[model samples]
Target: MGLKIYNTLKREKEDFIPQNPPYVGMYVCGPTVYGNSHLGHARSYTSFDVIYRYLKYCGYKVRYVQNITDVGHLVGDADEGEDKISRQAALEKQEPVEIAYKYELSYFEDMRKLNILPPDISCRATGHIIEIISHVQALIEKGYAYVTDKGNVYFEVKKFASYGKLSGRNLDDTKSGERIDIATDKKAPEDFALWKSADGGHLMKWPSPWGDGYPGWHIECSVMSRKYIGDTLDIHGGGMDNIFPHHECEIAQSEALTEKPFVRYFIHNNMLTVNGSKMGKSLGNFIVLKDLFKKMNPMVLRFYILQSHYRSVLDFSDESMTAAGVGFERLRNSIFALKDVKIAENDDLTAYPELDALKKEFLDAMNDDFNTPIAISVLYEILKHSNNELNKADRDTAKLEAVKRMIFTFTEDILGFNWNMADNTDSGEENNREDKLIEFLIEIRKQYRTEKNFAMSDKIRDTLKDIGITLKDAPQGTTYTIS
Candidate 1:
């Protein structure tokens, strides 16, 4: 079967055929870079990373573009309030760009730890001010945008009849539910800003056509995506929280100017929740990626996310992470066992029908809108069968190797798991020796603990820590991880 994707634009799972064959252009909404990246950021990026990987695996030359909002993301999701970076800069007593660059680097570092591939183009809003100004000019010339006396420009949402099509709310209803703020001088309450007038106090103002101001939050993605990729995107992805107002305004302005579809496939990942509320900085319940990494393996967190469908809301808790860690260990152990099986010259033709069946099931699950949960189950099935075969009196070494290759293809290749990088890089014999020595030391430490020699056990841990090995004591037992 061909690939199918859940397009938020169409509101259904549709077959994914690229606008240009052998090439796909994807643009995902990136972070604001005003603060540290949290779990919500991880879910959105990881979800799109899988899509980018899968597209490339299917032979589409994918050019993925994710932008950084260094400026112009206002507070309260409105045309008012200080820019997020400006707000953070005032708190830190630093320049707005300084805060943006700091968090931007930190965000990339955390993403690298999670094994997410970098985008082909990491556009920044501030860097694209010229293009954004030109885009606003085109919108105004097309009569889709208008400027107020204060030099602030707003998109004419009434001029675009399909303003609320993406969010499924008509102008009448949107206006009825809209909360008018005294800060905006928009012609309509539902209309959004294209450009904002900045005062002397604003730290991040640029020379735009509308005076010293910055692009609006929604305009940056529309302008930057077109400048980097194209006017019509093959895939545009973000969290579901961005559907209304943000993406809604993007569609209004982009389509109003181009008179074409802004995005063909609109993919949205559901939010990650903690204690039944969204895990976000606004809620003060967010877990930063760097802090989470110090507690557990980053791949463990990735595996926990893969356990649920991207469209489904995932609840975060320590218990869920522990379960995911256990599952990840099981997967790694199975792959390790397969690789350990010795191979001799084999003339015997082993019929491993299970291997082919497992591949089919895995692909089928993935092709159905990237169903990673079901696909991961197929990995366990392959592992279970491989373990049973390896334990037999006459093991088919060729079959074992084939199973290992399949596991690598699914985990490392498609799922973006850096298994080999995370595992020992030494040769087989050297790794075996190191493993045995570590196990021996751990066993001796256990013996010391059993004898109530707390000082000796502590000494063992402290000595290992000094040598770049950190030991964590948990209910399961004490385990050492090499730093």
Candidate 2:
């Protein structure tokens, strides 16, 4: 079956076929790079990372381009507050570009922690000034944009026949709904900016035909995507909140100039809400990911996001994270168990009805739009069977091995979530203070047991079990895990 994708532009699920065979072009709107990445940031990018990984794994060469909006992403999002990186730079008392470099490195590091491979090309808006200027110039020459006396280039939204097609709000309806704060001289209220003549106080202005100004927030993707991919891209993705003037203006400016579809399929992941409200800094509900890592495994955070469909709004909380942590451990343990156990010859298949059924169901769920939550539940079924078999001395070889591969491939490779078991890179990988200390104490407990200090051994074991990690005594040695 062909890959069925939910296109936000079409407002329906449709068959996904690329413009070219054996190669696909994908562009995802990356972080603004003004602040530290949070849990919600991870969910959106990691979600697309799985899609990028799976497409390449399916034998297609994919060029994944994600842009860093260093200069023009306004703090209030649409176009109100200060430049995000610039604002952060003020708080840190550093140059805006310095802030960009710091967080760009930090953002990729966090993504690497989750095992998300870096994109093929990482473009920055500030670096692509020429491309954006040329794009805005083309729009001007084609009669799709107008420049103000103050050197601001705004796209004429009323001139585009299909201005609101992507977001499903007709042009008339959008105009009525918005109390547009259009610069008094603009031709129309909904005419969003393509380039702005930066004021003297602006820290990150560039010289353009319009003046010494920066490109607007929406124009970055419009220019960068065309510079890297083309005017018409195969897949353009971002958070659902970006469907408005951000993406809509991009469509108007790009399509009005190029006379082609700006992006073929529009994909959006829903927002991350907290306490029944959307998570945002404005709402004062934002939690920094680096801060959260102090308390939880970052992999568990990724797993928690994957447990729901990408389109559904995921409400994050301690309770949900704790549940996801337990579930992820079960998956990790099943993978470990599979590596050690050898499969025996199964003479017949009918005996393992529940096991066989699970294998079929897991693939079926994955085949349908990569419904990972359903696929994860299918994994639990196999986890249940694997744990049952592990409890007993006898193991069915074929059934055991098959489920192991099924769980590993789907969960790790396809879903893009895995627990890191080996030594961390060039440093102690597991960063939680509590976890590292507990590991240290467990090592000492192992040594105590080795030295025949039964009294001290029991005390450490009892203490750790009460916290979370259970010390298991086996014939080979002692192993521990967080419950």
Candidate 3:
């Protein structure tokens, strides 16, 4: 089956077609880099990473561009607050540039831990000020934007006939939904800022055509996406949270200036919540990846995120994470166990009907809108059959080798797991130390199981799995393998 993706703009799954065949230009809204990267950041990036990976796997030479919002990202959606990085700088008593660079490094570090591929061009908003000014000027010339007496520039929502086309909210609906006070300088309450006039003491101001000001949040994406990719992008992706105002504004200003569609397929990943509630620092449920990495492997978190479809809401909890850890360990252990199997030196899958069916199922799942959960289920099924085959006294080395190749292709290539980190068999001393550590953990788990404290026992098992140790509970006793 051909690949299909759910285009948010179309509001349906559409056939994957690039404007330029065999070449895809993809853009994803990146972090504002005002703080540490959190679980929300992980979910969004990982979702797009799979898209980027799968497109390449399907023979598309993809140029993925992700922007770092280092400036002009106001804290308020109404575009009426201090810049996010500037606010963070004030809180930390540092320069705004310092805050942006520190957190930009943090964001990339966390993304690397999750095995997310870096974008082809990582553009920062500060670096693209010249381009942003040029784009805003074009919008003004086209009568889609207006410069106010206050030196602020706003996109004239009413002037753009299809302002709400992407968001499905008309001007009336947008005006009624304003929780934050609308900026009085705007021609209409719904009109958004293209550039905001910076105050005299503002730390991140640039000399634009409209006096000394900075580019607004929406303009940066529209500007940078066009500068790197083109007026039209094959795939534009972000969290669903970006759909309404941020993405909607991007469509308005971009189409207004270029007179072309902003994106072919607008893909949005669903938001992640913690224990059924929205994750937030105010609620004390915010999960920063660097802090979470202290407790578990980042790959386990990636596996957990992939367990649910990207369009489905992912509820985060310690319990759910532990469950995913166990499943991840089982999957990795099964795949890693075949590392020593000798191949038949013949790459023929026709004889292995079961492996062939499993391969088709895996590809079918991935092709069906990158359905990772279903794809992961196929991995489990492959491992189950492989385990049954291994139990036999005479195993087919060729069949086992074929299974290994299929599993590796899916898990390592498409799913983006670091098998080397999971199955690191270093030298003698390190291996000896890891072996003893596994034995120690196993013994503790056994005691907890004896005491009927299944929760504690399960915790021990899951914790060990998070660190690349897989324990097997057999009828005789519990034995462990270092993944």
TM-score of 3: 0.87
lDDT of 3 at 396: 79
Best-to-worst order by lDDT is 3, 1, 2
- For candidate 2, write residues 1-483 as lDDT tens digits: 557788988888888788885878899999989889997888898789878877776677889999998888875664444777787898999999999999999899788877788999999998888988998898899888899898888888878998888888876776684743446667877777788778747899988877799888988898888888887889998998888867888888888888999888888998888877878788898988777766666677778888988889999887887788788777776667777766566534356777777867876665566677997888887788778877788667666766676677777777776645321221223456556787788789889988999899899999888987798878876777777
| lDDT, each prediction | 0.85, 0.80, 0.88
Query: 1 or 3, which is superior by lDDT?
Result: 3
Each candidate structure's TM-score, on Cα atoms with residue i matched to residue i, is 0.86, 0.83, 0.87
Write down the lDDT that model 2 would get.
0.80
Best by TM-score: 3
Q: Which ten residues in a row have the lowest lDDT in candidate 3?
A: 423-432
Per residue, candidate 1 scores C-alpha lDDT tens digits across 102-220 of 99999998898789999999989988888889989999999999999888998888889887788898888878856556445678787788898886367788887778888889999
Best by lDDT: 3
**Deviating ranges (above 4 Å) for candidate 1:** 180-184, 282-284, 341-351, 421-483
- Supply candidate 1's per-residue lDDT for 404: 78
Model 2 regions more than 4 Å off: 79-81, 177-180, 343-360, 421-483
